[model samples]
Target: MSPPGATRGQPAARSRRRAARVAAVAAGLLLALLLCEALGWPFLRGPVERAAARATASVVSIEAPFRVRFVFSPQLQAGRIVVAAAHGMALPHLVDAHALRADWRWGDIRRWRDGAPLRLEALRARTLDARLQRLADGRASWQLGQRRAPPAGEAALPRFGLLTLDEGHIEIDDHALALRATVDLSGSEGEGGRGIEARARGQYRGHDLDLRAHATAALPLLDESEQAPALPVRLEGKVGQVVLAFDGRAAALLTGRRLDGTLRMQGPSLAAVGAPLGLALPATPAFELVGRLAHDAGVWHLVAESATVGSSRLTGDFRYDGTREPGRLDGRLGGERLALADLGPAVGAPGTAAAPPPPGAPPPRVLPQREFDLPQLRGMDAEVQVAIAELDFGTEALAPVRQLRARVRLDDAVLRLEALSGVVGGGRVDGWSALDARQTPARWSVDLNFDRVAIDQWIRALRRGGAGDDPRRALLTGVLEGRLVLAGRGRSTAQILGSADGDGRLLLRRGTVSHLLTEAAGIDLAQALGVLVRGDEALPLRCARLEFGVEDGLVVPRVAVIDNRDSTVFVDGRASLADETLALRAQVRPKDFSVLSLRTPVLIGGHFSRPQVGLQASRLVGRAAAAIALGVLAAPLAALLPFVDPGSGDGPDPCTAAPRSAAAAAASAPRR
Candidate 1:
């Protein structure tokens, strides 16, 4: 019925039509699928629909992690959540998707604090809870740490705090917290940037801390707090102009663990933190402090540039490093001017002197007290120049102690006061002493060296007794020249042991030699100056060099003196310090130096002729008035003058305010 070629052509046409029909059907199916999706229909009505529902079920929010990777096509395939950025931030290890969706999803909040994060192995959540302080690069965190660093020299980086677990552990309130995290935070940052992040598993906080984390996004800060090892942090920087390295915890400190290291510091004047505290450590000649301090404990040192304590310009070096229990002071601190009228209260001195030192307390040492951590103190050595104000001496004459400097140290409560050379009462005093309070039974000792002291000057400083009282008699007048070296040690009154050596001539003019001079001299003078005699007229009496030696309780050579009028005065004396009485055996013309004023328990067994003299006290007059007056004195009408208050307790504080005297004001004229 058909040819071969015709048959072939017919089959081909049919095949072509079949292929076209199949293609049309496929296109229709695809269109149907797309339309269903747009119309919110389920493509895989059973399995796919159910799966999608379960996927988002109760999820409140999603916390995308940096580890997440995603590929979108006809079929979407996703890897783990990923965070990629350029910031200083640390993120978590894992997250519990279920838990995160339920309650822990972070809303649009900026800051988060006092929150714990639980990390998990699987992408899902578990039950382990790990609360870590997470910080972000923002202003909120930077403001939190600002409590100690203050806003004065304020500059900050966002930082977080996760105090040591040993500091203590926290208990939970509930499991309904608002914020939740399900993934680790990955990071990327610009130069010198920092960041943080973390994850939580089975996160459930209903009534827990309402941690608030809000801040400006562009800020930089410490974003994470891990369980880092407790180590001494050494900061290397400049403190004022001084370039110094501070050693950190060479010995055990935190929890008795020694962290050894060094932190170098160098800075401008405003940068020296310690300088403001009053320990004036040496710095560049520009009033800048530059030094290195190494401490064992996590402690801060103190310093001062120019601080005034009760009118005393305390400008010196003082350091305290607390390592041991009692601590240690390695260097010395002294000032040019001095002021401590309330010394009894200022330096822990109890009210009444008669109240007696604490049982057997050693005399006051010039060193600071042993109270704080020992090794924490920094050593000091500074030179301070200052001026002093007026103070009470004895009589109406003001007492001024000027141009004074001292080197002091306190090691384990054993304070050593040395280089205690000062000009007082117009005299030079040298030598030092020790106060061993380290032991339960405190002890004391001192070695004093005195130079030429004009005796008459000292008497004028005392408060007058009465209007009719002996005015000239007030002058324990004498050309007191010699080295009066006294060395002694004592614990209590009965335990006192020491001796004194006085080698010099006691010149008496218009004074009683027997009463004032204890060198076996018995010359009774009405008025004494550089001479001693009995008549009211001013007479001069010269006494031979006096010498006395005491071994335990026994006295040798009793007393002996040569008078100016070619008179030899000798007296034997016995003493009972506890009784406070003295007996005399001698003659001063008429009254025969008999028992003088017998105030102390002493017996005299020496004789003397009538020499120019007047009976008086043993503490001779001194030219102290000149030596103690360091600065210029105010005029009699100074109190009424500009900026001058003669009665003001606090005199001029050159380091701070202006002067109180007209003359001082004139001297302090501001220069252009």
Candidate 2:
């Protein structure tokens, strides 16, 4: 206090002593914290409960024996714990446990905080009850706190190294799946190894469900050792008339990380089986399928060994990847034969298992009217190639298609069929088609071409005469070629066709027509009588050409003509696709001389379902007057000449000029 230097030294010493005291107190507090941690810190139960309740947004309570310790890893034990549901949840409680214990690794906790899955070292529970629920709007009762973004990797589930449970009950109610189930679960440990078994009773998609499952204990699932065995699992379940069974082995259950199994299912309809899984499977007749199923990461593979739907059979390998933003399906499917009728349900045709319409409802329409599920198409992408040796149309009028192949692709609600080729009626068809479901009402377009088709084979005679008659007699014989380009917008096939606008043309070369029909058209009484007395014969044709233009579902003939050795027939017609009606007139111009002839036109009219044919009354009246006046004023020969033709068939071949005109018109037309 007296000297200046002494005062500065005294202040420094006091500061050093104060700092030493602070260090000692810090050391003592750390030592006490270590001791408490080793003893599980039972006295901190209230604080722990409060922290858990705040974290879960639920009411958490624990009875005596509650304890927690955190040195490097965390350990928890409690007696008679109860966790109430989060606010706004329908259920009152999420979990009620008579006894519960859990342990976790320090590294796993840190990894979980950094977006990795949390792994538990051990879990043991007794008399536990847990309830889980999911609403249609995607709210889940078990979801705690705010929702977080999904992890970057596979959405992995928590794993456990060792698990023991007794008298456990689990209930699940999922509105999206229309499923409500209650399960009784138990676990066992023995020399044979740990195992888990469960029995469930529920209702799924309006069907009563009964299920049983068994699997190797959850402990091995957490083991990453090379020597660990794959968990063996077996599940058998039935929902109403549908039966499902699976026997498999997996690296981890319910994760689809790695799985190998045999899956077998049989149901009244495939639609029913897919209902609870939210798959838009096509409606089908009673069916059964057995396949080798495997999964890795988020992809599923199925190699169908045998699949039968009604009388149809198919086998293929299919791959489905659900990890992408929009799921994708890729597959190559083929079979020896496929019945078109069996696939009717896919295009809205009524299957054999379909229920009849109500008594008061109108009969089903001829064209398919079921609207497409456009939203479902946006949920997935696909590229599938199909090939079939034979495709049966299920009708005697149309021959079976052979060597059918097509590549189908779907992306962003747009469906396209490319590289489409098939052989039918001894003809080749090549084309491409597309449906843009992204557009309202869905726009559709098709450009198809038919080449080198045998017309006679497609138009067979309905009746047969004696053995002496030719069995191959047909209405017409020719090599035909045609093209069609059309576009429309609608939700169903009928509506699409009703609004279609297009142009088309047909060409038949080196063909023949019915001799009797040709003679009757020209009213060649002598030749017609002679042909009728004998048998009908085939008359060689020069050529036939038909071209049409369509506008707003109305088709009008631009050129319709048939040229043969004896006569040239001209056809004028208009067909209404909207009302399904027909109106036509045919006039025959005789190319040869005939004594008795009536130059009258033929009229054809009616609905597509019922057509009427008769002579044109106005034309017949004019012809009659001309004949009568000629007979009165001049000789009978002169009178007959007015009604007969004096050979006008020697003109320039119209067939030669028609093709050139058609080509020019096509070239000048605007392209879509």
Candidate 3:
């Protein structure tokens, strides 16, 4: 019984010893594996290449010295690494690097495998070359592998803490944008700072391009942490005649973070500069601008220290909020002077220096016919207040506007100019104008009122006779008040006017006309000759009025009268906005007896470009007989009593009291 118990214990002891040896072997094997892993597992290179090729759908290769290690983190080092372009791509290779090294946390690697972006703690490359291309159809060479649906929510961007580039060459050809460029890059590190600098030369659209840029150390730039410091940057570039420069600092550049900087730009025209960038900026004369630029919370801000376009100069602060649907632009801009001609291009008018028509092209139209770019209005919403001390009309015929102020708003394809008020020629004008681009042809409307405008200052007469005449001498003196309301639908200013249907009335009070002109109006040959010999003098006018109705672009006079002490002049006419033609007739009724008078109607007929004025031939043929009849007896002066002034109190306002039927009858009367 005792021997049996001893043998059993001995077998148990042997089993325990065997277990210990097996544990020792296992520990040695584990130790060897860990050592190999830390030293870099070169054997993983083949598998890595295969995995990379599968992931990118491209050819991937690695020369000797390629290795990967996974201990506390994932580490990669490669020699002569190359990644060929994806299948169906034209380029041979997308990336070729003589040396590359990268390191990332194991937790990041796990997250990357779970559909998260790959983030590296550090990256370094030497002698790297990259070529990128985007086709017209939107296919991009960098977008390797099969297309996949975008992840829900905002997609995360690839990030890194540190990036070091020794020597690199990058070439980009974006067919869709018509951009092509080649950049030579070099890593710079010294007391000045550590960063990458580049020089680029290429073409964008059809313009030649050259650019140079320098940035802060790559470490801060690559850091995605919120605590990362701002990265300093500097850039200068030129495309054709356009020049641009910037000195800036950015935080979280890859994540839409804040950016603050100074920017400067100059170019032959805003249109030329915006063309390459696909911006619908208005065509304008040469321009230069300096501003402070900033971006924060999806909004971009610019405070222009000085901006000059043509002869116009302005300073303003503007902000663009991209967080809103269709975006929004808000700002207030004010200046001492604003050239109307420089602003023409914004409303489809020619720029300051309009291009000459082609050799065989027809003469330019009197009105601007270029169609408004309506679709651009729908791209963004804007509310801007503009105030200018002076608005130059760029013509001596029209007086410059003073204290011009307006609020411009664009929303949902409708552009409105509201609260518009200005002073011109000692008069105040208030108006509201709107352009509704939602319609195909676009609808336009305007309601304007003028108060107490000095006629002499508003309508300047061309000086003659070698400046002998006083330039300040008024050809006509009056204070004019008017109202014009019009509405039409068209794609251009000309087209809108051609289709306009509106009415207007103008009243002139306390006025005077040239004595010689008043005498001629009455067809008093002796009086006119005598007035001319005595030198023309101001003849007091009781009242003057002009009222018109527009129907389908045809303007017909409703009331046109000029009453003076000597005579009452009546005008009847129809002006065709559609054809730009004029047909008018004026008849003069003398208030007093005349030694010689030919009561013939004056006729005016012609196209806008060439006008003709003459006395009615039929009336002229019997003028002598008519003069004899009038000379024999004073024609009943009672017929014109309604137009004669009472010589006291506020006389009858011709603008309101003139007979509409008389104007119509005069217009429809027989030519004779």
User: For this target, which candidate reaches the highest lDDT against the unseen true structure?
Assistant: 3
Task: Quote each prediction's TM-score.
Answer: 0.37, 0.72, 0.78
* lDDT per residue as tens, model 2, 1-672: 379888879889988998888888888889889878877798989998998777666788888788787876688999978887544577867778887897888887667656555467877788778776666665655555424423222233345676678877877676755768787778853335457786678887777888777876643432322333477878788866789888988664322356689989899877776555334455777888899888776687888788887777777788888778687879987877778887777666667645666776654345566776666667778888988888877666656778989998889888888999999658898899998989998988999998988766654442134222353455567888999888888887767777888888888987788878898976677778888899887778789988877767766667778888888887766776776766777788888777667767777776664677888787778878887898889977666766665656656665555432433433433221
Per-residue lDDT of candidate 1, residues 1-672 (tens digit): 899899889989998999899888988887776665454342233343244224323111222321221111122111221111112223231111222111122220122222222211112222222222222222121222122223221222222221111111112111112223332222222233232121122222221112111111111111222221233233232222334343342222111123334333334322133343223222211123333333234233434445333334444443454443443334434444444432333223322334434755654332222232212122332222222333323233534544555566555445566676656556665677665654434555666665654444544442145323453544234444433333333333233332222221122333333334432233222222223444332224443344344344222322334343323344333332222223343333222223122212123422111112233233112212322332237544332222121221222221122213323322332211
**Weakest lDDT window of 10 consecutive positions for candidate 2:** 148-157
Clash pairs, candidate 3, are: none
Cα error, residue 568 of model 3, in Å, equals 2.3
Locate the minimum summed-lDDT window of 10 residues in model 3.
641-650
Order the candidate numbers by lDDT, best to worst.
3, 2, 1
**Residue-wise C-alpha lDDT for candidate 3, range 480-524, written one tens digit per residue:** 999999998898888898899888988889878776777786566
Which residue segments of model 2 deviate by more than 4 Å? 1-91, 98-127, 133-167, 173-212, 217-230, 236-243, 250-259, 266-287, 309-311, 343-345, 348-365, 458-472, 520-529, 593-600, 620-651, 656-672
**CA lDDT of each prediction against the hidden true structure:** 0.32, 0.72, 0.74
Question: RMSD in Å for candidate 3, one decimal?
Answer: 6.8
lDDT of 1: 0.32
